[model samples]
Target: MATGGEAVARLDDGRVIFVQGALADEAVVVEITEAKKRFARGVAVAITERSAHR
Candidate 1:
């Protein structure tokens, strides 16, 4: 998790995406809100799988 509770993940091309409303270890479909060279900001559009922690 990030400082503000965003879930951290990596894209297929290896860019880090900070996902809103997602939990660690959970699989989700992301909608990117912002993008930069090394990182991106996104929201979880759909949860493909959920973590037991949630």
Candidate 2:
């Protein structure tokens, strides 16, 4: 998760992934639906770790 409350992650290939409905500092599983040259967009499919803020 990001500082702004959005989930920002990096793939193994170094691609940037963004997810909504996620808490900052939380660990989650995401499913990518769209892929671009620089980044990919997805939603939080599962939350592995709950954040204190959530």
The best candidate in terms of TM-score: 1
Off by over 4 Å in 2: 1-5
lDDT of 1 by residue, 1-54 (tens): 999999999999899999998999999999999999999999999999999987
Model 1 spans with C-alpha error above 4 angstroms: none
| Model 2 local distance difference test score | 0.83
Q: What is the C-alpha RMSD of each candidate to the true structure, in Å?
A: 0.8, 2.2
Taking all chains together, each candidate's TM-score versus the true structure is 0.92, 0.81
Which pairs of residues collide in model 2? none
Q: Give the per-residue lDDT of model 2 (tens digit) for 1-54.
A: 566556888888899988877777888888888999999988898999999978
